[model samples]
Target: MQIVIVLSLLFIAIILFATEKISVDIVTLIMLIVLCTTRIITPEEAFAGFSSDFIVILASIFVLTAALEETGILEFMIARLVKIASRGANILLFLVMLISGTISAFMNNTTVTAMFVSPLMGVSRKLKFSASKILMPLAFASILGGTCTLIGTSTNVAVSGYIDKAGLAPVGMFEISGIGLIIFVVGMLYMMTIGRRLLPNHQDSALTEEYKMQKYITEVLVLPNSPLVNQLVYASDLSKKKFKMLNIIRGKEKFLPDYRTRIQANDILLVEGEIDDLITIRETKGIEIMADVVLEDALQSPDIRLAEILITAHSNLIRHTIREIDFQRRYGLTVLAVSRQGETLRTQISDVKLKLGDLLLVQGAQERLNYLRSNQHLAVLEEFSQVLFRKRKGIITISAFVLAIILGSFSVLPLSISFLGAAVISILTGCISTDRAYEAIDWRLLILIGGMTAFGAAMDKSGAAQFLANGIVDWLAPFGKISVLAGFIFLTVFLTQPMSNAAAALVIVPVALQTAAALDSNPRTFAIAVMLAASVSLVTPFEPSCILVYGPGKYRFSDFLKVGSGLTLILILIIIFMVPVFWPL
Candidate 1:
């Protein structure tokens, strides 16, 4: 009955995770509550995961990664790499994949992809290649690289911690290096050969390409007999249409119009609307359309510039309509259009609720845009040139990180303490602020990891893990132990598509351990296999790193299937052959 109840809860949780109706962290918390309320696990056991050493290590890594980014070291290093990789397209792709993979082995792959997006765009322009050709490969390389180290991904740390609790030897830091390096090579070669051809060439449809607001904007002269003459701007017929009154030009003077501002005869109105609407207004509303209008003519000043800004997940503007936020009044910028999910939204944009991953084309003064850097709301994608570098602080923080790694490797300090000390040094040296350190840690991911770890304990307590493992072993016992190991790897890889890598690994680790014990095989080998498998087999854009590049790459869902499927299959075979060889399952 306990096994049945636990299995039922696990089934429901898996459905919720895949459906994404509720957040993953919430689902995990629910599972913990159910387990505790059912007396499957005590309250102490349910909450124990939050105090685990792995959680501390994971949080410290987040702070350390943020400090490295803040110091401009990553930008400085990537810029130098781009210069050297400027030889040709293929070489550039290869070098970028290698660099991105190496960095992702240390930092989060999502962060790595975000850092490289603008640089790779610069590379695309310089080499006359398309971003679509490179971005998918860049995201995939980062995923592959996460397989290289225990600290490389949350999945590795979670699985290692689980094994340690099971009384098996913990995973070494560089234990996966041998297989991981080979898998990276295989992925790189695949992208260079077949994956390159499968990728789209989106050079012509760059985000800036669609930012041509000149054609969409028009100047109209209010005729002497116009009904809107001497009418309040808010009460005018122009408000009924989709046209937005940007500014009013009367003779030599210009003014930005508001609701109370009145229009007069012969007053030139700079209106932003569709071309068809502008033509219709001229024919029906006693307005004269000006020919040969330029973007400069609509705005009075030459100081204002147009650029693309991405709404990050941390942005305050999310869930609010553009007009509700009074975006023009608050930021002193005019939004031209919004790009999201590979579609350019030009009409009804004012009513569209902003979401993360939306790209907004905005025209504003350089000073106002400069203020955006400190806003922490929107990222100005155009201005990648201005990088902040604190050389002394960067050197100190980097040295601290290396020392932490050394102490951890030599067993002089626990991995968590070493990294936590490094993070403290980074903050003390002013490499990153306390607030920035807090912002850098993914609280949702931490919650999910913590809550799910308790679920692992619940499964163990309820005998659900043993029951499932016995079933799997009974079914696969006809095959060799190696075949059973391969089955677990495949199961983990498939599960990651529906859940996070760490969640998938944690869910599978307990079962894999039970199965290994039943078969008299090394449980640590199965644990490590589950961890690495979770990192690979990323055959969809559901992964955060892949989602970051999806829009920039201008890729279809099929593109990942075409390219990532082959790579995932290759890596599976590699893991199946490599795992037993290393741990002798």
Candidate 2:
């Protein structure tokens, strides 16, 4: 009955994750609640995941990474590297991926990708090559690089903590570096040689057309007899119809409207709304829709700026639509459109709930965008100025990261404590504020990892791991130990598409450990394989790193399928044969 209950919950969790109707962290917590209520796991067993040492290590890394970001260290370093490598497209791309990949091995993959996206976009324009060419390789390299270190990704730390709890030897800092280096090299080589040819060559287009914002935004000349004339801009007919009045052009002056600003005769109002309704306004008394409006001329002025602002995983505005947040009033920036993956929302963009990695095509004053970058956890892609660049702060932040790694690697301090200490130093030394430090941690990811860790305990407690292990061992017993390891690797990579890398690996590790025990093979071999397999999921753009690039690179679903599917296969082949030799299956 307990096994049935756990299995049923697992089935439901997989479906919920695939549908994505609810957030993954919420789904994981709901599963834990069910498990505890059913008495399948004690409160301690269900909650043990939250108290794990790996959780500390994971949270500390977020804080440390954000400290570096706040100090403008990583972005500054990347821009310098890009400038130095701008001699040729081939050499430029190689260095971009190499530096990004190496940084991602220590930093969060998403952060590394975010740091590089803006600069690379600029670089691609300078080289006259498609961003699709370099961005995809950058995303892939970051994911592959994380496989090279125990701290390279949260998946490694979580799996290490789980196996230790299961009574296996703890993973050393550099234990998997050899196999990880092999995976990185193969992934890089494949990306440069075969995968490079598969990338799309979508040329950079105008910001308005790139995000499909021109469908809604346009210019209209207000006639002298218009009902809107002499009315407050905030209370005009356009406002009632939900047409966002972005700017007012009278004579030669271009100004963003406010409550004090009133509609006047012959004023050209720059507005965004449903395209058909905006065009229909020509028939309305006293409105003339301007034909063949060049959006660049309407939107850009001496002080007006257009750029892409990314909603980060830690953004406070996640799940809130543009209207709900009063985004314009708060940030003084108009939302021209929001791009998710390859789909750009131009119609009713206000109703589209924001998600992590969604890019907002915004038009605002230069000062306003700069203020947003300083105050918010958002990235402005076309204009990412390193406003917080302080020489001393940068050195201190980098030293904290280095000291933590060195201390933990040499056993001077436990891994978790060493990272925690670094996080504290970042806070104390004025690198990042206390509130920002807390906000920098991706609490959703931490919850997903922590709650799913408990789910692994439930899988063990309910005998589900043993049951699955028995089936695998029975089926693959004749095929030998390598075959059983391969079975688990296949399961892990499949699960990663709909699930996060850490959650997928956590779900599979227990079953793999049980299978290894049944086969009397080295459990470490199977554990390491699952960990590496979790990061090898290039078959889809579902990975956070890939999602970050999807819209900006203008890649299609088939682009990832054609290029990443082949890379995933190659890496899996490396894992199936190479992991056993490293850990001795």
Candidate 3:
């Protein structure tokens, strides 16, 4: 009965996750609560996952990555990449994938992917290449690259921890690197050859039209009979409707009108708002649309509005409140919108807190705009004219990261301590700032991992894992241990597509371990198979890396299913074949 209850809860969690009816973190927490309330697992056991080393490591890594971002280090590296790859689009794409994949091998793949999206989009646009072609490749490269190292992804670290907990010798970093290298090679080859051809070549055009804001700016004349003749600008639709009253030209005196100033007859008000809405306002508010003057002038002289600006690490805008920035005053530019990771900011953009990699849609003087590229503290992502700053900090940051890897790999220090120490050294050496360090860490992801870790414990302690494993073992007894191992791997890979990779791994690892015990085979082998299968989900664009590229690539959901499904199939076959060979039953 406990087993049935647990399975039912698990099924419900999966459904909730698939439908996104509730947040994944919430779903995981609810599962834990249900398990504990029903006495399926002890409260202590249900909460053990919160104290797991995997959570600690993931949290620390977020802080470390956050520091790197704050110091403008990633931007510096991308700038250099763009300068070196000035050859052509094909070479640029290849180099970008190569670099993105290589970096993802050591860093968090999502963070690495996020750092590159803006620059990659800018580079693609400047080179007159389709962003859609490069973005998907970039996302795929990060996913493939993550397979190369234990620290490459949280999934890898979680699996390793699980192996140690299950009383098996943990796999060395290079043990999986061999197969990962092969996968990377095959994946990159496909991207450069056939995959590139399959991508859509959407033509470059201004994205502003998508917002439907073209009709917003219009001019109005204060007629003598207007009721608003003696009223301040704030009392009229210009202020009420959030239109910027740019200027008033009376006779030959062109003056920028203050928002609080009153209007008079013959004064022209340059306002911005939807044309239909403005027409309605004019009719209702007793004002006349300056169609012959403002409309005709706008039609005759089409002004090009472009904004160039730097994204600073310490800007209060990072991850909090965009509305607080008062961007119009702080930057002297009107923010039409913002773009991040190929996804346009869909919220009330003016109120959204700016993150480090955000690309602002600004409108200001072109001359002053170009100056933003030279701001070393913030990356002027779209401008390629600026020289890349190869400051000494790059060496310091790289060395610190390398030292951490060595210490962790050699067991000279615990993986958590090694990274923490490296992060400290990087800060002290001026490689990254304290503010940036904080921004670099992904707090939401950390919370999700921590919460899910506890959920995993609940699954294990409830006998849920054991019961499921036993049932599966009984069902597949005729096929033997290898088939059982294959079944587990296939099950995990499928689960990962609909749910998060971490959640899927946490769900499957316990069952796979239990099954391995029943078959008298190596539990570590089964655990590793589950780990690899869960992390290598290339069959959908739901992953963060994939979502980052989805909008920029102009890719349909079907595109990923079409191309990524085949890749997933190949990966599954490889895992099934390789896990047995490396850790024999």
User: How much does each candidate deviate from the true structure in C-alpha RMSD?
Assistant: 3.8, 1.7, 4.6
Q: Give the TM-score of candidate 2.
A: 0.96
The local distance difference test score of each candidate is: 0.82, 0.87, 0.70
TM-score of 3: 0.83
TM-score of each: 0.87, 0.96, 0.83
In candidate 2, the residue pairs with backbone N, CA or C atoms under 3 Å apart (3 or more residues apart, or in different chains) clash, namely none
lDDT of 1 by residue, 1-585 (tens): 889889898889888999877878889888888888889999999888888898998999989888887898887888888788878888889999999999888777777777777777677777878778988999899988888887888888888877887788777788898888998899999999988887877664433355556777778889999998988875678877767777788998776665568999999988888888777776866788885355554564555566677775445686789999999878877787887767788888999988666778777677878777545456676535537767788788788888988898788999999999999999998999999999888788889988888888888989999999999999998898988999999999999888888998998999999999999998888988888899887688888778767766677788788888888988999998898888888
| TM-score, ranked from best to worst | 2, 1, 3
Model 1 misplacement above 4 A = 206-304, 311-331, 345-356, 370-379
TM-score of 1: 0.87
- 2 or 3, greater by lDDT: 2
- Of 1 and 2, which scores higher on lDDT? 2
Which 10-residue window of candidate 2 scores lowest in summed lDDT?
A: 381-390
* Tens-digit lDDT string for candidate 3 (324-431): 755555554456556664556643565665655456656554444555554433444454553444457666767777887888789898877888888888789876
Worst 10 residues of 1 by lDDT: 203-212
Counting clashing residue pairs in each candidate, in order, gives: 0, 0, 15
Q: What's the distance in Å from true for residue 212, model 3?
A: 4.3
